[model samples]
Target chain A: MGDLTPEVQRIAGNLLSQGQVDLVLGWAKAPSNGQSVPACIRQAEQAGRLIFDQYCIHNLATGLLDHRDSSERIGIFVKGCDSRGIVRLAEDGQFPRERLYIVGICCPGMKDQAACDRAASGLFGETAGDSELAGKCRQCAHPNPVIYDELLGDQQPPFLNDVRFSDVQRIEAMGIGERGEFFSQIFSKCIRCYACRNICVACNCRQCIFDETRPQWVGRSTSAADNMMYHAFRAMHVAGRCVECGECERVCPAGLPLMLLNRKLIKDIDQLFGPYEAGLSLEEGARPPLSSYRVEDPDPFVR
Target chain B: MKSFAKSAITVVLDRLAEQTRTYVPMRDGVTSNFSPWSERRASDLALNSLNTTFSPKGIVFPQTERLYDFAVDGQRADISGTHAETGENILFGARACDRKAFAALDQVFLRRGYVDTNYKARRDGLTVIGRDCLQPGPFCFCDSMGVDPMGADGADVLLHETTEEFGWEPLTEKGQALTLRLNDLLTEKELIRPESAGCRLEVNVAGLPEKLRGMFDSPVWDELSTFCMNCGVCTYICPVCHCFDIQVMNNGSSGCRFRCWDSCMYPEYNLMAGGHNPREGKRDRFRNRFLHKLEFFQERYGSFGCSGCGRCLVTCPHSLNMVLVINRLGEVKVDAS
Candidate 1:
């Protein structure tokens, strides 16, 4: 905290003063309380309000969508996760990558609010400190942005965690009947609210296929089959493109183990196609394995 | 590229398991899918096996993922989203069909607007190790798409299964790095060329776009529509189909929004907010699926979207294979020839 506050101020002030950007999008302490929220500051004087800390978990990339068509270039402060979203948006050509200046910050794994609450209730007293972080932060693999124009903090090393497919392995160990029951139970809880789809950065579409009523592809009733269709179909759409950001699972109010569904797909994609990433670099001209036709592809189902 | 005795393939797999999670095709009950490799699991890791009941797209896209989470109190809202950790893993035994599917998905998700950051992160950290397919299955028509059964374009590390020995070739930097780590398990030897097999089906889709355009109003769709249940099993199982929808939800005072998968087979797929449905009928919807695959995706990305994985044939309740549909559609040859 020695020069953090001052450093943020300096960067924000300099960017504004030098006309590097018309607006600096960063986190500022809420005027009413200690909470930090996303702010779009235009003047150098507002730099004093900018803050950077654990509470600054909001993905600033969402704000960029609002400014996509704006003439004024924006300077955004991004955490590792937010930077990925920005990179994805840029890769998709949603906006010009050169238009914005990125201020990246390295992150250590953040806390999980719900997981901490359960752990505290069992062992420690009511006071558990600030053991709560965002759910996505808890399992974050890339706590540092891969691409950034101006990094504010010292670069952190890449995460080297062991591959843990324990949840999927456990499900695989269960009998077929048991596995069916498990998925049935989990899918049965789906209300078709589509909270997962909304939060997904990859899910930015002007008109979604689910909302298309002319085709009547899927029914409006939130029945068990319809919900399953919705979840499974949504997953397939983003298949080979989902980055496993964990935003969909965290937003689920019902606390569904949504990560398991994604993990299962990720595992399968790795097994089927060669290693491919969504937006790291745009070097290869080849399409994703699932979307392209190849004459010699293996298809044992064909007689 | 070095050829090792059939017995040595297991040795390489065992060594891979010591450091990374290794997956191989295995039968879980009646359905076949990729499962983790174990030393005593030789029977489970069936090489050159039948197509799994499910498409392999699950490796990257995932069924459920958190885009970001936001909560609003009064007028203020807080949001949080995170990216996956980066690490190397070996995709032990991928089939060529699924490998081709990755290319199609990449075009739709990665090539189109906003490279999916989440897919990029997970994909970059992965190394695809492919195995050759010796025999074509019932629905196999990858040959019609001009894909090589023993190709290594999509694979970082390719393992060619020969009659007497298995050959391993590293095609990318990631594969080379993985090979360096697995030096203890492998012996350095020259790469052995693989024998190529003839494909089951041969198709000239060069004129497919023009053919489809003329046939849009053809009665062939009536024939195709008779068997279609409109269940979307074909679109759901196809490795390259990428249509989706965005939705917003409110739970009391606070709510979140999402974009989920959407299919063209359903009648409600084209309905707007004011009850306006564009592709209202099954015939139009069916036509859209074909047109998008054979025309639109190709028109946009310079390639047809179908990877010829044939999962659609197995999953479809009526057993509708695109090859047959395309062939039947092509039967009424526009006489332009």
Candidate 2:
């Protein structure tokens, strides 16, 4: 990772100098804590601020939405999961592929900044060490980017313990009432901060349902019912489109088991839609299972 | 000095809980916050942690609260204020920074010739028991914000943590009353007051308010807000970022007006009735937040809006925080127009 920074800087500098990109999105060491945070470099000289490290865990794909309304060509760096975000956005027609210069990194997993923060804050009684890999990275099936104009680093294998749907299976094994109780307990802790929704690349709606005031699709209260509605609506909306980046779970301040909900939907989609994974490619006119209808599609819920 | 042994601290809390709904710093799953204490949650008490993940401000000003109830039938309207009397409550083991935030909140909801009935009701009954922050973390900068880690300005009772016992000092009439209630549990003892150790992270806020007053149009806001994703995590988790929106939920004719936490970072925060937004861009919203914390708050109140508990430092997914903003703002050369 240390050796790859020079190449990243060189490529970003070259892109900016040649005016091939209006902006380069990557990670830079935060001056406050020395932790790698998202950096937007518009000038070739500022490209040196960029760095790639294990602590650069934030999914920069969500940041692309800030420029969606503009015609500025963006040069972005992506990990395996983040590349899926590009696919998610491009497929949704929210962003055009022509406006992007994709720089992909063959991710080797990253450490969780929250864990490092908790440990450093001395707030949690005992927290995971800074060196611990993020829980999301542990379940990653793709360590290499699916799409990129130019790639960095060597490709890597899937993480050791790929129990992607194991947690979903455990929840599925629970009885109906117990599962309801489990979900309610977790949902009750939600503060309605919307960090999970805001951080998700798949949530690219011009006007989110939760924010609609005219119809008020979801109640704003942090009550059990409202929280459930918020999460359930969000999960259903992003069911087949979610790239399994595990970012929603990672950014949740309440520590809710959001991946359980997301992975459960993914597993169901795979079963019903016959082995499908989202954000895997940029096929022309291809749509997620939930987005496009098929004549042979199962309609178990419709009946 | 009246003191209680560290082992008997729970006994003190047990007695306090009998009198009022006691809120204590407790671990909740992956995070810690002030929650109503019970025997079952006694094991989760995190007195020695740097600061709770969430601030204890919700004890007085909740995240959501009903302002009024209204019913409209046949062109006749019946409206009732939902100003229920908040019963006695105790906030135990709050640090100086959090306690200072209560003072900042007090200025907004209680002072300036206008009073919020709901905030006043809850605040009047609330007794704050501020504990000394002996273990300042890497992110803490309360001292830089003019807060003393050893002294809590508005706390009724101050609990000084030592190796074996807590040296309790009653500072107000309310503190005295609580001291009398726990007389049996406490014993007179002489203990060394812990040395006040300030935070490792320090920012010079001197002349910051004055400098920020005229720098609203500074280009620094653009650079600072470049990577900010405009999430509500910082404001919602902040102890003193007390912005809210009043909304109503109507089921046909009967509805209740409620207020919930709102963030300036959101696009809808500044949306006007005419469908025009003043602070429409991320840079505008971001600049307003930093100014409010540094300049506007000081002009409106006497002190800074931020208590510097550094909650945003840890929780912001993008790493955009007050410390970074302050440092960048201080470094930039601006004309004091």
Candidate 3:
């Protein structure tokens, strides 16, 4: 992908200098030339640091929640998936909509950091279908921001794939015992590092269930049992709220196929609740599928 | 000195496993980790992997370890401390960076004024086999961190790999004993090791810890923390981060106390029992994590806590690792100086 540094920096500098926003949230070149990390440009002078490239894999919207209570307006740069995350948070009323100045990017796709490293190519070595882009990006439906104030580049055409949930289906096709083994093995790799939970924008609870001491829902231990419960509970919690950003799976150090569980819920949410997609718009998401349901909604467990 | 053919290392490991448990870098789905030798373990031994996703420290200091078990009967209460295992652990194929990390860990758990007996026993019982990392990973900066990828200071035995053979050099009594046990498999050969190709990334750590003393109020931490996803990957992957949380796991009037790896990046790590949390913001937690690795640990251990394994560089969601912190802080320091 071509570097959009000049335009991104110029726009961010304009916003910062014009006093239009208290902070301009973006990505900057990390010490590793191939990688770009999230950057928060509070001053106009620092806007030169902002850059947009394939290495900007982190969903910057999750970082924006830290500034939710602040009254000052903040300028945030968001890709398609990241824009959906912003809408997820906005639906929960964590960050006020008026305070957010969204600078949306027409994302092609962000490449996987590990794959990029293995490619051994210094920069812009995103080989197509070599598993370079994150699985979410690979199965990406929307490359254009769903919600934004101002657009950066021309809108990207819809990039949805016919086999978006093919991988999820493979898991669904497995027997109950086989699925249990698959997930059991996935949780075995978990170190209880909380990378999956921390990177997720859907996990916005002030006090997490994992941290509770008296009840101790999820032990701090990395035991397979603990890991399994932690993931199962988290999957249900983000059921209707998740925007399929895939940031949770992308951020996991253990390489857990978290989206499989999520995609299953998403499919069920669509199948039973009659076609629901969370975070499509900025407004408080249409009551959600599980939270507000019709009597006619299918109950697979019952029948 | 003894040598074994590269292809025959598994046969050697199988023989070694008969005496004691042998650990090698094994593939787990996508990532590689130093796990106990098993039928499921890849025979290739993941030597091609630059660095394992988790450090070898887990072999010595497991993520979750029971200190003691407590039992409450109908009338009486019983408490029992865990006994140290008899059979020793032979950790083979550790990279020089990991060996250096063990040296750093030695200062924390062995030579410190208050030595932890549990860590000491585990340290004493285990034998480390260091491997020369001929080709450093894309993100490896062990050279910049003053670590030679070919050096084996902490390892009991050193092994250098080539296309044909693995040159084994024993450095300690434990390694000598193991060598003698494997004498049938090993043959006397000239010690020829490969020269490291060096690291792709270079981080200047000269006078870094001292320079970091005055950087308490620096704005760089804010910038770095903005991108930091606040995950424990860096700390867990780090070879020498020894911070742990002690907890009691109770089951129906019976309980067991164990300690698990704790990351400063976590909100709960520094949080007190009271309602107030001092390091509530990600910036403060992130700053503390780096400061501990760069400044605090250096002050206490007289060496930086990082080994430049680059596991964190690859694993971190935002690519936020020690190299990034060191380079960025170094840049700021140079600008100020």
Candidate 4:
């Protein structure tokens, strides 16, 4: 991919200049030094402010939820993984596919610059090299978007060496007892911050079930069992549908291996279901497997 | 139906290995659970053991599954993608209650608004080998839910244990194929039916929809709510609870997003961003839980949401059983016209 700044500017300017889209959504530097965040550029003049690099990690789909009923067509920039969120929203029938223009970039996996800084120092190390990107980026195969109306750079081949579940393999190598202990220790660190949930695009719910007071399923206490239930149940809810974008783990302040839990589900989904992707297509009327039922489905419980 | 002695069942497991991944109950250290068959060892299998510590739902609705991934700089999102390793596996030694529980889950996760292809693929590719429950645990209550312990309603291959012989009945084409593949170890024998295990808990959920509607304001919920610490163990261990939340994470310019499970018991479950909780207290929360399972599910899916597996009885720190609560609710005499 070309320098992210120029590529973002060129794409945004073209979409705006040609009147193909009413607005261009990209990333611009946050007020903090070199920290980039999602931004909406309504005019060609603002395109120069756009920046794309390791700092542009937010799944901008959350921002689009407000625009679902709008009549104007909008152009949005996205990395390969971020496109899955849009695909999911489209699949859910949350938005009209034709109203949006996609400026897909061939991403070369961005880093969790914050985490690298934290590792370098007790708080968040400031001296860590830019090369010390997030683990998700290091293992990313399709850093480039699978679906895009306009491409910003040369299409790179998918990474063949990426092993999706290497972390899961490490955890599975331990004996059952050891594995339990390891998970319990990691789970104990969860303070129920819901940061992982807040940062997840797939977790978009009008009212999260965890917050439902009627049944009182999970308690307010941050005990071991409660924490375990919170994390485990949350992971199960998104099984088979998770795109493995690794945003949940990145926003986690406690640095829990939240991605491992998601990857484990992805692994199981692949193991049980045929190879499936979250959102690489615009085909309407296609259904997800978990939502449909067959009367003859194999039931192991009946005897 | 063909009958064989208990000893002959081991030969069936051995023969099953020739074709597919055969799973049987085995002792892993001190605990006994169903796992993939290792060597051809009869002692490794634990056929009559208690329900596995983890529910068999993982075989269908796995924990920590991916819904999909997408990236968005702003208004546009793209979702077309595929993951590696979607294959097939077999689950052996699933119990009757767990089987019935899947039937209920199938209604929620599969039969609901959006068809989850991930779940459907696993449901399609997997074969369930069920064993009849001769003994019911203290917490077992399948009979109360109108499920027959010995009935082969859900099993692909149903196994019946008898003193003189073990009977294998194929309820579906997949089961028939599996039986045919293992036909080498079988000898044609007469069918011998076993007696049914009587229902352990008696629950009249027939009028529960009306009964619960009138009983919503009843003080009975307050009594049940007192014991609940809101631990969420019951929902986690439950095979049918399917509520969830979606979120997005960003660090600078690039980030991934996801969805995870959520429970109704938490205070934050219904709390909006402005610190407003719709179901404010334990009483309201308690009522909504039962209403969703009994009334809402019936209203939407035409059946009670719960399958009566009784995992909540075993896992609850307070011993608040749903059966006992429902029974008490049933006893609340409301005036009829």
Q: Please, what are the lDDT tens digits per residue for candidate 3 over residues A1-303?
A: 456788889989999899999998898876456467777778999988788877677788888778877788999999988999988888877887789889889898877665555334221112224455566687777778989998877777665565767888888899999989988988888888888888889999878888777678878878888888998999999998888888887766666778988988988788778577778776545567787767887766885
The DockQ of each candidate is: 0.02, 0.68, 0.43, 0.02
Residue-level lDDT tens digits of model 2 in A17-77? 9999999999999887788889998999999999998877888988889899999999999
Chain A TM-score, prediction 1: 0.82
What's each prediction's TM-score? 0.52, 0.97, 0.93, 0.51
Best by DockQ: 2
Q: Looking at model 3, give its docking quality level.
A: acceptable
| Residue-wise C-alpha lDDT for candidate 2, range B129-165, written one tens digit per residue | 9888887888899999999999869899999889999
TM-score of chain A, all candidates: 0.82, 0.97, 0.90, 0.88
Candidate lDDT scores, in order, read: 0.66, 0.89, 0.80, 0.67
Q: For model 2, state the Cα shift of residue A95 in Å.
A: 1.6
* Deviation of model 3 at B202, angstroms: 2.2
lDDT score, residue B174, model 4? 87
- lDDT tens digits, residue span B212-285, model 3: 88898898888777777677888887888889999888898998888889998887787887767799888999
Q: Which candidate is the best by lDDT?
A: 2
User: How many angstroms is residue A101 displaced in model 2 relative to the true structure, after the best TM-score fit?
Assistant: 1.8
**Winner of 3 and 4 under lDDT:** 3
Tell me how many clashing residue pairs each candidate has: 92, 0, 0, 97
| Per-residue alpha-carbon lDDT of candidate 1 for residues B1-337, written as tens digits (9 for 90 to 100) | 5556777767877888778777666654323556667878677665645555445665665434435556778888876555343555667777787788888878777777888776777677667988787765545667677577767768998887777766778888988887887776666666555566655555567688767767777777765654343445566556676666554444555544444556787655676668767877666787788888887877888777886765554333323457767776766756554
